[model samples]
Target: MSDSNTTDFTNPSTFILLGIPGLEAAHAWLSIPYSIVYAMAILGNFTILFIVKMEPSLHEPMYYFLCMLAATDLVLSTCILPKMLAIFWFRSREINFDACLIQMYFTHCFSAMETGILVAMALDRYVAICHPLRYSTILTNPVVAKIGLVVVLRGIILFFPYPFMARWRPYCSTNIIAHTYCEHMAVVKLACSDTRLSNYYGLFVILFVASVDLAFIAVTYTQILRTIFRLPTKDARLKTFGTCGSHLCVISCSYIPSLFSFLAHRFGQNVPLYFHILIATVYLLLPPMLNPIIYGVRTKQIWETLLRLFPPKGG
Candidate 1:
């Protein structure tokens, strides 16, 4: 981490997060909203995890990825929200710089893994919907396990450069990060040395990696749709797309905000700074909150499993 991303606190160990400026002054009021969002995000993702784990009938590649997705979201939101809420609730923005960097690294890593996991889910859908006969052979437990390992490694490998890049520079003495969490680019920008190289690298990775992943998913689904069209019943078509509903929701939630945020950063001068920061943060939080609900409730087996897990008592 650079001094640019640090504050000259009395302790030297901790720095205040420059939370949304206006709201920081009203901690008691802001805490109410932040706490609510943090709670909802946690509970929602946990419920999805519960259903996926308990529902034996959902023990397929599709739901397995859904489980991974929900689990990732649960952790992702937890990692950032507690600190954010503390900042908002107590007017306590103090976070250790090492702690901030670690938080940023894991957050980036898990986020990358989530994208990869979603890609796997898309491939699973394509196989199940487009090639039913060979689905088992192609997406077996061993294969899925291998893919899981790849996703985790991919996450770590992809974002590992940021910390190293930060280390390579002579950091500046600025403290206030424009956003809530120490985002990689924001942190990289904090360095006193030339960040043009790092900036280009970050953009290349985001565009190349995120774009390639999205494009691959798009092509797989396009093929799946073509296959679904040949099915005898209209219900079969909806069923196939339905299997992808959760993934669709995730992709939309994740990618669109990124597109908009990037465009706003580049093009719009009048746009409020908090708009960018808040939207970016929300995009991260929403998928974890919504993934389980979108994927779990829509799944018949998971819905049934959830019911079984929480049955009516006085029937």
Candidate 2:
């Protein structure tokens, strides 16, 4: 066995994550809200998955995409929040180097998968609304499963290099990360070696994966809008738009904070560290917490199923 005392100059042994810098005194208080959000995310996503799985009527393409979304949300939040809560509740901020790398991998991989899933969901919407007659033929169960597999594989491929690249760079300086979770950019910035390659690749993944997904979503929605506009009656348009409301809300919830967080991290020279950190945390947690609520409120099927599951006492 290798000696624990022996040090490798290239790879860090451990990293100190300074959660919520300047608000160290408020970590305990912060944990309250953060813990609540984490609980909501877990419960909400689990409920979505359970409901979709248990209901035979919901075993369709749209709900299949939702199942993937719920799974992604569950994973994305789980990858980051537990450690964040540890930092807040127990002040356990020292993460082993290998563990940190693993956490970073999950964070990026799950996020990429989430983006891809959202794009897939948008495509599903486009097909159902624009080509209702061909929807079944286009997005069959096998096709949806294949799409899910591709999303997962694409995410893994994109993020696989991040940790390895960061690991090879020497972290000779004080290994302090100014965030609660292990993110690729945040961790790589601490390395002593030149990070041009890391930066380029990170930007590539962000642009290629997230930006591309967003672009596709926008295009799909545009086509959907054109189709909706051409509908014969106002009620048809309203009903169709209502069906899309939940997804639009979810898309906004996911992408807005994500874009803000990315911009702040990369280009917000005048922005405060706490702002970046807070946005990153929210960006990570908010979608998972809101997705189920949005779907439940806006989707008649899910709402009715939920009502049936929790019937009125008097009834």
For model 2 the local lDDT of residue 238 reads 96
lDDT for model 2 comes to 0.90
By TM-score, the best candidate is: 2
TM-score of every model? Answer: 0.90, 0.95
Per-residue accuracy of model 1 over 262-294 as CA lDDT, tens digit each: 788778889887777777787788677667667
* Least accurate 10 contiguous residues by lDDT in model 2: 2-11
Candidate lDDT scores, in order, read: 0.77, 0.90
Clash count for each candidate, listed in order shown: 3, 0
